[model samples]
Target: MFPITADWMSFVIVALATLFLIGELLVSTKGIFSILGLGFITIYFASFLDPGMFFVMIIIYFFGLILMIIDGKILNDGTLAVIGLVCMFVSVGFTAPNMVAGLYAVIGVFIGGISSFAFLKVFKKRQMWTKITLFDQLTEEAGYSSINQSYKELVGKRGITTTDMRPIGTVMIGDEEYSAITQGKWVAKDTEVEVMDVDGTKILVKDSEKLQKKSAD
Candidate 1:
């Protein structure tokens, strides 16, 4: 024990640890926040529990934190996050010296986790979280966007079906081939087709012969 007489100190220590740890994972803090968080958590656990229990509790807490990070960065769902928070709560609450300290520690975990978001406003976020959360969007200005400008230019142009469009197949437009759909029509291979629309990467085409026949009718 670290000779801490105050029960509220548990809350303070745990809260600061969680805040910094979560902030470090969510944003780019250059490891400063991680160090501070680890330091506080170590002190908090060491001050109340035996050496063996201390290590166990620390492992549980970190396991929970890892789960939350994984959920936020990859799953983008609350299921794993909820389980992770529960694990953290168990570790801190079980290691406290008394019921009051346990409750305080639990509340601290929740508050600290929630407060970690404040750091996002103060620092540049990690690229992984930003992408998963859609905080950043891919656009033409990004220099390597997936948006293909060539497909957009193909609208209203004439082409020939290189493969049978059992509504979907390839079309040859001026020696360049593109994947195209025939608006639910089954046009045969080698049929003349005209580019009707372009939605993102999807190219919609219609049979040029049918279009001419309809026009003549």
Candidate 2:
């Protein structure tokens, strides 16, 4: 069923491989999945390589994992993540028992990434990505509150741009400051604007003077 011609055994092997390896990233299995992942990956490599090369390939695979952690935690850019994937694919392809196993391993990694999404719902993610992902919505202390029905009241109100709205900026509506955006228009600071829409906390606005001029003409 894999891209390459994988036998029934290859299916079982890749499933366990991805399960433990990718599963570890998804939830905090507390070293359990790590141990299982290492064991399965070792078995997959041992089927084809000598003791010397087997250890080398294992190191490369873990190195790829380290890069992924760096990408997720430190850099937050995707550069390390891509490099890490290439490293892992190379390790698997080079050490697999046959062409079929190599393809299966690569496919397994992809499925594992997709499957990781499921963990976010059921499990508490303690990973670094959690810190950067929608933290404002997670807590009110960080200055993020759910958009209440009252926000609709200001939809037609006029305001002044507190900052340059290069599409997204802040505007002051009456005495309250709100984060708002323009309709793909560049608005300068201190310029007058009118709220056009409020979808939850997303406030969309347009230049009030431009609207007035258009209405007058």
Candidate 3:
């Protein structure tokens, strides 16, 4: 015969909630367990009747939230485990008519508050997470090869500007139009200008003397 006040059901719920929290942490599947854990705790808390018990539950919930922010993974898991143990002990050890209800209420509060906070933190942080890419490493290697190549060899190199660069524009050097800084002052249209210097990707050039003299007028 189960005590009218204390039942195995409370212990079972707490145990299950703890497991859910653990699962959520281990799997890193967002805040699924966090939500469920809080829901279980809320239900348990509601079943109990003491004003003082609710207050205690609120305190526990607040503590868990604080721990969650600073401690994150460790606190999230630890709080659930501790609360689960407490709930199990209270449910099984005491048969007072109001004991189970009070304990359940506390458990609910602990789970709801802690889990909600944990879930929100995880959700917010997830957005900023970035995956490591092989291209990042390759960029350095590629840049080295690109830098070592001769720009002077491109003196006569020709390319179209991808963007209008006022007096300067992109000139297709081989497959890439480098940042062509024109020396001609103003080389409108796709007028041809020889590569004067290929200091890095900046291609410096001037309009042919004929064009320059005509523009000077």
Candidate 4:
């Protein structure tokens, strides 16, 4: 009865940790929840058992941590699921041979560390693949009137063109992008253009003249 109770508690601890770790992944609140979850599982495992059982629990805890980090950082969802199943098999299978306990623990930690490193490298590469843009002097209002606020009123307002325009294009103001006709015609690519008139999304501006004025002011 006592052994069964302990087992149940251990299971609960592990289950809660796993769920919390999963939550950390979905909700991107940084790794706070995940670290908490790991702590819970570690305490539960380490506190409730005898030396032998404690050692085993430690192995399982570290194994689970590695699995989670790999899941989050390296493997896609499907692949992580598969790895989870495999880890379960390993944890369960190692129970029979007490002599090889240390080996199992070492192996689990090694797999986890390697997978985590790989995940970090992949994440860095992904960041490199993305492009970031900045726009200044935007308005929170809507429609042509809002456009006017950003352009005519915001004589020194700066904005980014969302779409390409032969001479006319779209510029962002606050949270809204306005249609702006260029001040001196053709505005190419992501060239920083200024707001001249607020017709609507229709904004009129030369290349960065208004931005310059805003900076001077």
Best prediction by TM-score: 1
Q: Clashing residue pairs in candidate 2, if any? A: none
Tens-place lDDT per residue, model 3, 51-116, is: 667556534543544444334443445666565445434432332236654465346435533454
lDDT of 4 by residue, 1-217 (tens): 1222333344444445555554554344467757976675455544545678767755765565567556655554666645754564455334323434434333433443344334343332233112321213344642224444434675557767777767767777567776767655777666677655556545566778545787899
Give the poorly placed runs of model 2, Cα more than 4 Å off.
Answer: 1-8, 127-134, 138-142, 145-217
In candidate 1, position 106 carries an lDDT of: 98
Q: Write the per-residue lDDT of candidate 2 for residues 180-213, one digit (tens) a residue.
A: 9888999999999999999887999999999999
lDDT of 1 at 137: 56
Q: What is the lDDT of candidate 1?
A: 0.90
In model 1, the runs with Cα more than 4 Å from the true position are 1-7, 27-31, 124-135, 140-146
Q: Highest lDDT: which candidate?
A: 1
Worst 10 residues of 2 by lDDT: 1-10
Whole-model Cα lDDT of every candidate shown, in order:
0.90, 0.77, 0.52, 0.53
Q: Where is the poorest 10-residue window by lDDT in model 1?
A: 128-137
Of 1 and 4, the candidate ranking higher by lDDT: 1
